[model samples]
Target chain A: MNRKTLHVVFNSLFGIGGFCNAILFPIVLETQPDSLAQLLKAPVNFLRQRLWWLWPASFLLAALAKFADKKICDRWGHDAVKEMLEILREKGFPGNKEPVHFHRVTLFKHKRWWLCWRFWPWSGWLVPVVRSGHTTLNHQTCFLAPDEADHAEGIAGRCWSTKAVILIPTEDSNMTLPLLNPEVNAKPHDPHAMAEIYAKETFMDTDWVLKKLPHSRSFLGIPVVVQGQPWGVIVVDSRATKIQCAKGILASYEEIARPFIKCLERLS
Target chain B: MTTAPWIQVEPSLRMRSEPRQGLQLTLFVPPHEVPQAVRGEFDKQLKKFVIEIRYLDDEDFKRETMDDTVCLRIGKNSRRLLGIELDTANLNVAQVQFQLKEVEEEIKRAVTKFLQKDQAQEERENYALAIKAIESKGEQLLNRSILAPAL
Candidate 1:
């Protein structure tokens, strides 16, 4: 059945079960006498009584109703996201005309320290859930610290801010030159140069202020927005600097990010 | 066990000579600002770190001293460790790791600021040198045309 019809049937069953428990069960229990003999007799009377079956029937219905609830949640958990994407194609998503696409879509939840990502065909299984809050700074897998501002693995964490992006302090004039222009920092520059600069600089400053992660030398980060407000960032990094410089990487990152935002919106 | 990098320095002769010796780092709290009890309580929360408050007078005032200041000294107990006196004020253990992190950030900021200032100065010097070269070349060209061969 369609979602709307299923929703209606579930609500009606729940309402009838709630009314029976709240009104009928109490009236029947209270009318029974205090004496043991009368209590023993009560059961026989209930068997003959007009509304005696209603109490047990209500409980049975409530159980069935709960089962339906779980079933709907499990079914919608996967399909709702797919349906939302189809809707985005027809009606358009908040501001963007097209969806974002990166290697995998990541969702950084609000208020919670954990972020989750589920790949296609993987369903709910084996999604890498990154918990930055519980992670120690020097831990082998701990790349992002809880307190640190957002940054792609390749670029120095200090480079970009909501206000401005500073020049990477390196011997390479090319990297520093591009960042000096405020406009270039806001938008991605020549893909090849950015990839090369980020990779070399990350390697150069391995022990420095940069938050270094393995095989994440070439990187791009785009803000994942929800309802015009900044929710979290979608960061894509690559070990291969040469591959990152190829055209369309930035657009792909944006495309992958869009539906992921829609999924967060639906789940929240 | 190897000593942490932050504890590399030896205590100054003055500190070593002191009767009551322990590891100590003093924080400069401006005069009449933070109460001695509050400072003591903060130190107590650190558990292993002991807190001592010293009221500063004119004689005690050094170039580094701020007005209305008290110093908090954190150190290893003399009874616990024989004679490995630490000269450094900053704690380096995992318990005080955040403080070490702050020190790292402070160093990075100082270095970045120094480099930026140095770059600006170099840019100014290069601009001046370029102007001087252009002026000299123009002068030589004029001199050759007016006083020597025009060819």
Candidate 2:
């Protein structure tokens, strides 16, 4: 069968499984009486007496199941993203012509809810799908390390709690990558304007460089748009301070974005 | 609270002249951020669009909330479209609130789209303006050269 059909089937099964595990199973287990004799003893009285345990039990099971569901989805999504990155690497990072080599291609997944905490709003995280760059320093400082447990909590404390991904939803536009060199690009608040033009593409300039990784000069990112919504960003950063932007770079970024968006669409 | 069963009514079927709450926006257009003339024109255009734009569920439910008010026609022809009545009788408070949020998102999206469209429009106009300015300056320079040689 084709990839699209396979994707639809996978989604159907995932949804059904999620419903059964998170809703149906918990409710079925929790609502069942411990003893039939108790119900027989008093049908109306049984609800009043047994409901206390059943409510909490149902909630607990449902919560656990929901957590499991999110974890499963995250794992599946990470794999799909990783495969796309590998494909991008194989293609030699298209549109990326001389002096603008992709030192590293990073994907930052935006977790709308922090650890499934609905009330906490949005948080962005770099998943361990693929990485290519200077091995030690770049890996350590650029992306979130696998063992970085307190990062989310640390983000919560800062005033700049908003992730770079947040810019995508706000400003939505498209343009060629190289057209935005500092010399010719005279637009004030270029970051904000870039957010719109390359609404899909995220650019990490000086401020972001200073804050996140001083090693990387500029980062070009594109949103992985799945089903008309942005799922995450595919970022390509250069270790050099200035990089040439050209038509080939735009074409390459677009090519990478298209497949990345498609893979995420399958997950959606 | 009167528990009268609320029936969904088509917004178009309701009286257009009925007193309803209008969508109010407080835009902060910083000085020199946008030319006053452009900002003024944008404000007027945006207000017109908001009023003219149909309600969020207008297509599906035949509703038209004038000026971004979440007014719903609960009953048939002989219905009231007043704000208090809309909240108490016509609309489901919870559902309307939720729909209002969706409407807000749509409006924000619309604003972004509009700004982009407007920016493109301004760019074209600016391009034309630049050509006109250059042409006029070139003509003056030519005229000066002709006058200088004659003198």
Candidate 3:
């Protein structure tokens, strides 16, 4: 059986066993202390006393399954993105001077009640579930890895919020990529125009999107939609800038969303 | 009719639908301009030709339908022409090739109409480049079915 089916079976069995034990185990030990003593004498219960650890261990397995699911999603996302990049190159996509990097910044909504204990908010953060690495760049330096973007911040977040494609180019050079609070405003499409461009989103800066790697001056974020809801943004970053404005190259990479969502639903 | 070196068009089969074997006609421009494609079932090519001049969000520009299939994207604030959306679903793109010249003329006319609305320097330049791209690539789309390769 599939892992999911196995998990469901295990859960149902565990639920029934736990319910029976919740009442029977305590009652049996209370009325017949000798039975409890005999059970404790078993070799398996040597360290765990009454062997109550089994209950918590079962729950631990379920938690681990969740963590594993995230890892699996990441692995799948990475493969799909890499394959997509390859397709673009083969199809003669007019790309950038520097190697272009694409990331799937998914909105991970912490829906489960158990997830409340996590540091994440109920609304969830726009985390880079699938990240790509290159020779000149490291995955950690991207706005993902260590710190994810808030649902209302950055080009990716804004795309999610507006459900639109947000393109911030370098040749026009508007954003500061500010690591700090909002600062600077410029005319039309200058470095300071971030204030006007990001009038709704206060954190419209990216000076430190790459703390260690080379700066990503141009950004094109496309909102990924599935079943009429916003899922995430396909973030394309170019080191040489001008991915959109003033030539350099305007690619039709927007269709990457097609293969992306396809892989998501395929169960592959 | 040729595009400037700065503005380029690299045509690629950006998306192929499921079902493995079916005819899909994409009189396509390279897939730039829009942020993404709304995933849907397109058994036959959507019978549309979309040339997104600038990549834009839905709110960035307001789409004004010139006709049932022909539409122009106008910037929300600048009011300049942004792009063209033509629904060619019923139109046949085949080897017989009778409609190529007519289709090209219609496209040129539509673009000219959009450019005439605004005479700004930026609009003028955009008009030139867009025409060049259409002229250069419109022929490749003219005589053959975009799905010829698959066939």
Candidate 4:
């Protein structure tokens, strides 16, 4: 379960205990005021009464605090993802006129809990891009946002909930193409074949391009480099048919991927 | 291909580049004196580097001036383009130097700033959440305090 849900469950359980204690403590004080006076003094009855109620009240308050925290986290998490998606919408695809849809988005940590939010129209994914060597998300991830550390663990988690094809552009010389046709071990030196592999790996159906079409698919991946070392990749999925993916689009995507990458880069 | 390299002059400047083809340099000079100063520095600095120096002057400034300024151009084959402007009319030596330093520092700040910009909307929402959480807790505590009996 996600942290927000786990927190809510824990808070509810604690709230029940708190409610019982709050109700019981006052009754116990009212009934056993005289017995309690024998232990201390009748003049100190007020103190005793307060002591009896404070424990439960404090517990109840704690439960309330936890509940509020969960609510805030839920809202913030949703808004964060929404804002990112909106940016993509406004920016649109770099060069392709075809409308881009976010199929699936997720936020997950290697060892810690994972939170996945699924949207119907277009899948939006938000994942914690951890550093190259680190296995767990921690307080450092909080640096990415202002109040991310307010929680007990000091870090939030997210995951994508969609299945979409990612377009990989072939222009960037630095790009190391992912193996598309596993059957063909040989790297297709032919640009046409490479484009076909990209199309096949990305699109579920080949009907989009029946034959090996020129510039049918473009591959876009943001390199998350930390300390001059390549760490991870943030892949962009687009299905623009007319315009080919260009440098400007790549640059814009780089701008979007930067924040998450830096946050992960800073994590120890 | 035939345009002469633009040269500019300003107070207290430094230029450096490696040997390459098609490099463009645009320089901005002060009203009058700044151009001479920039030209002097460019000549000295040019000897140290393999870059071609272009001096941008009065007429170029008139034609291309977005506002009230002049720009110089210099380069070979036009591979690299650098635009330099002089704001000596409003900026002093110290201010100009500070600005140059600021630009260098901006490169570093850009790393964080770009990240912040990337998640600016998200951060704003997160801030709202944090404020709400704090406010709710505060209100609850205040209510309890008010309901409590006198000390």
The lDDT leader among the candidates is 3
Q: How large is the C-alpha RMSD of every model relative to the true structure?
A: 25.3, 20.9, 15.2, 22.3
Tell me, by DockQ, which candidate is best. Answer: 3
* Alpha carbon lDDT of each predicted model: 0.32, 0.34, 0.43, 0.32
Residue lDDT tens for model 1, A1-268: 8766776787778878887788756755665544448656677456337466777788789778767855684456345444433332222122333223312222232232323221122121111222112221221221232233444232322211221111122112222222312343578566455544444554223333223323332333333334433444423333322222212332233333345445555453
Ranking 1 against 3 by TM-score, winner: 3
lDDT of 4 by residue, B1-151 (tens): 1122323222123111121111111111111111111111112222211111222211121111222222223122211112223223322224212343432233223323433544533422222322222222332222222111211
Task: Write candidate 4's Cα lDDT for A197-262 as tens digits.
Answer: 554444322333334232222333333333222333333333332113333433343445444444
Query: Candidate 1, residues B9-123: lDDT per residue as tens digits?
Result: 1112101122221121111111111111101112222222222211110011111111112221211211000111111234232332234343223323433343354463332
Query: Per-residue lDDT for A68-107 in model 2, tens only?
Result: 5555544555566666554544344445454423355555
TM-score of chain B of each: 0.18, 0.19, 0.46, 0.19
Model 2: colliding residue pairs: A94-A252, A95-A248, A95-A249, A173-A196, A173-A197, A174-A197, A178-A245, A200-A223, A201-A221, A202-A221
Model 1 spans > 4 angstroms off = A1-13, A21-102, A111-217, A227-230, A237-263, B1-151
Where's the lowest-lDDT run of ten residues in candidate 1 chain B? Answer: B78-87
Instruction: Give TM per candidate.
Output: 0.30, 0.32, 0.36, 0.29
The TM-score obtained by chain A of candidate 3 when compared with the true chain A: 0.45
lDDT: worst 10-residue window of model 4 chain B = B25-34
